[model samples]
Target: MLRIHFTDADLARTRIASAPDPLWEICASLHRMQSRQGRWAYADWYRGTRARLHDTGMVRTLRTLLLPLVPRAAYFPDFLTPPEAVDGLEAGVEAVLATGKERVRAEIGILHRTSGAPAWAPRLADPELRQDLVHALRRYHALAIAPHHDRVQARIDAERAARARAVLDGGTEALLAGLGPDLRWQHPVLHTRYPEDRDLYLNGRGLLLVPSYFCWGNPVTFGDTELDPVLIYSLRHEPHPSALPGDLGSGAPLAALLGRTRAAVLRTAATGATTGEIARAVGVSASSASQHAGALREAGLLVSRRHAAFVLHTLTPLGAALLRANAPCAEPR
Candidate 1:
C-alpha cells in the first residue's frame, strides 16, 4: 500500500497534465512488451508493435539495450522519465540528456540493485551514450507510437475532459475521489495499492496527475520520493476501436450542420494547429479559416491562444466530447 498525505495547499495545487507524457508512455509500452499483463486491453497494439519492430530492423538492438533499461520490476532509472516530458518528446530527451552525471550514476546503481542493469547501462553517464539512448527512444516512438498517436491522444483527451467536468461539478475532492478504482481518496490521504509498501508526504509541493494510455495495472510514482511528485495512471478506458485521426468530420449530421470546411477545421484543431496551418490543411483561405475558427471558439468547441504572432487553436472539453461522440465507426486507413 502507498499512502499519500496531502495538505490544503497541496490539494489546491493539484492538477492534471494537458497531454500524455512521452517518456512514461515509452516506459509503459516497453513493460507491456516484456509481459502479457493487461493483454486483453493491448493485444492488438502489442502484435502491431512487434511486427513493426521486426520490419524496421529494431528488434535486436531494442531487445539488447532499451529493454534492459526498462525491466518489468521495481527500480527502472528515474532519469529516463523526466518530469518535464509533459511538453513533448524532444523536450523529454533533452531532460534525459541534461541529467547530472552523479544523478545518472545513482539511478543506474539503484536499477542494478533492484533488477540487474545491462553491462552497457553504466555508460549512460557519457554524453554520447545518452544521445544514443535518445536516438533509440525516438526511433522506437516513431515506429511504435507515432502510428497510433492520434488514437492515444483522443483517449487521453476524453479522460481529461471527464476529469475536468468532475472538478467543475464537485470540486477537488470529487476529482480526487474519482481518479480510478485503484486509488481511494479519503480526506487528506490518497491510498494506492502499490507493489510495495510506501508513504509519501506531499509537503505542499503538490502533485501532477498524468494520464497514460499504456501504463497498466496500478498507478506509478517516482521511486525516489525526493523527485518531483507525480502519479502516472492508466486511462479509464481503452482506445476506442473506431477512434482514428481525421475521422472527426465523419459524423454525417455534424458535417452537414457545420459544413465540411468548418467541421474539418474543428477536427484539425483537435491536434493543436495554428490558423495558417489549418488553412493549408483544409485547403481554405487563411481569412476563411480564421473566421471558422472564431465561430468554433464562440461555440465553445475550440479555444485559440496567441503564441507570438500565430494563434494556436486547440479543442476545448466540449469540443473533444463532440468529436468523440461523432467519431466514425470505421478505422482510418
Candidate 2:
C-alpha cells in the first residue's frame, strides 16, 4: 500500500498535466514491450510496434541497450524521466544529457542496488555512452511511438477532459478519488494499491497528476521521494472509433448530412483540436475551417472556447454520441 498524506496547501496546489509527458510515455511504453501483463488492452499497438522495429532492424539495439535501463520492475533510473520533459521529447533528452556526472552516477548506483544492473551500467554517465543512449531513445521513439502519436494524444485529451468534468461536478476530492480503481481518496490522504508498502508525505509541495496512456496497472511516483511529487497514472482505455477509415467518409450518412468538411471538423473536435489544428488536419483553408466550426457550434455539435488567442474546439456530448453511434462497429470489444 502507498499512502500519500496531503494538506490544505497541497490540495490547493495539486493539478493535472494538460498534455502527455513524452518521457513518461517512453518509460511506460518500454515497460509494456517487456511484459504481456496488459496485452489485451494494447494488442494492436504491441503487434504494430514489434513489426515496425523488426522491419527497421532496431529490435536488436533497443533490446540490448534501452531495455536494460527500463526493466519492468520497481526501480529504473529516474534520470531518464526528468520532470522538465512535460514540455516535449527534445526537452527531456536534453535534460538527460545535461544531468551532472555525480547525480547520474548516484542514480545508476541506486538502480544497480535495486535491480542488479551490470557493473558497466554505471558508465552511462560518460558523455559518449550518454549520447548513444539518447540516439537509441530517439530511434525507438521514431520507430515505435511516432506512428501512434495522434491516437496517444487523443486518449490523453479525452482523459483530461473527463477528469476536469469530475472536478467541476464534485470538486478536487472527487477528481482525486476517481483517479483509478487502485486509488482511494480519503480527505487528506490518498491511498494507492502498490506492490511495496510506502508512505509519501506531500509536505505542502503538492502533487502533479500526469495521465499516461501506456502506464499500466497501478499509479507510480518517484522512488527517491525527494523529487517534485508526481502521480503517473494510467488513462482509461477508450476505443477511438473515429479513426477508422470508413467511419467518416462522404459515403457515411452523417458525413453526407453535415457535408464532408463539417463532418471532418466534428470528428477532429472529438479529441479536442484548435481552429488552426482543425484546419491543418482536414486540409482546409483557415477561413473555411472557421466557417465550418461556427456552423458546427450553431448546430450544437461543437463548443468553442478562447484559450489565449486561439479558439479550442471540443465536441459537445451530442456530437460525440452521434460519432460513436455512427462508428459502432469500429469500436474495440
Candidate 3:
C-alpha cells in the first residue's frame, strides 16, 4: 500500500520558517499574475503558464533555440512580445487554473459520494466555476509559452528522429540477430507517456496538494498530497553506476560540501550565514561556496543579506525541512 503522509500546519509553518528560497513566492506571484491577466488574455495565459510550468526546461531552452524562429521584431520580455500581441493569453491561464481546481473537486466529489460523508456537501456546490478556473490556467500556459515552444518541439522531434535512426541502424541489426523470430516490432519495447493532467499540478519539482474537502474527506480539512517518486529518488537515492558531472555521487569534494553547506544554512533558519563560514564548513573555495549559496538563494530555499563585504545566508523553514528530508537517514526507526 502506498501510504501518503499528510503534512500538518505545523510542518508547513516549519517549512516556511526554514525555507531556503522563493518557490512559493513564484507560485503565489504566478497565481496573482494569472488572476490579473485573466481579465485580459484568458486563453493565452492558460496554455502559456501550463507549458512554462510543466516542461520548464524545454520551455527555457526553447528561448535560445527559438530565437531564429521568432521574428527580430518579436523579441521582448515575458515569453510573448508586447501586451497587445498576447491578448487573452493571461485570461486563458486563469481559466486553466480554474479547470484544475474543478478537476480536484470532481475527484473529491466522487470520493465524498462514495464515502457517504455529509461534510462533503459544501464542496459540491458550484464545482464547475472552480473547474473553469483550472481550464483557464491550462489555456494560459499553452499560449503564453507558445512563442518559444515551437522551437523546442522542433528540437525534440529532431533529436528523437536521430536517436530512432541510430537504433534502427546497427543497433536493430544486433538485436534482431540475437532475438531471431522472437523480436516483434508490433509491440513497442520502449514507450513514453507524459501525464498532462498530473503534470499540471506539479511545478516540475513534483509536489502538490489536492484539497481533502473535495475528496472523500472534509474538503476543508482532508486534502491529499502527492510526491513524485521519480524526482525524489533522483534527488535523494543511493549511489548510481555513473554519477553526474557535479552530482553528489560524482566524488567531487565540492559537490559533497553542498550537503553540509546547505545543512549549516538550514540550521541558521532565516537568521542567515556568512559566505566565509559556509565556504570553510563546506570545505570549498569561498567563491565556489558562494556560488552554491547563490543557487539555493535563487531557488528560493535561502535568503541572503549583505554585511560589509560578506553576504550572510539563512534557510527559510521550507529549506530546512527539504534539507532534513533529503538528509542521509540514520536507521529504520
Better of 1 and 2 by TM-score: 2
Candidate 2, which segments miss by more than 4 Å at Cα?
238-333
The lDDT ranking, best first, is 1, 2, 3
**Candidate 1, overall lDDT?**
0.83
What's the distance in Å from true for residue 73, model 2? 0.7
- For each candidate, what is the lDDT? 0.83, 0.80, 0.34
Mind giving the per-residue lDDT tens digits that candidate 3 earns over 195-288? 1112112223322221110011011111233322111000011122212111233333334336665556445433445677777766778887
TM-score of each: 0.75, 0.76, 0.23
Order by TM-score, highest first: 2, 1, 3
Per-prediction backbone clash count: 0, 0, 92
TM-score of 2: 0.76
Candidate 1, position 250, lDDT: 42
Lowest lDDT 10-residue stretch of candidate 2: 238-247
Superposition TM-score, candidate 3 onto the true structure: 0.23
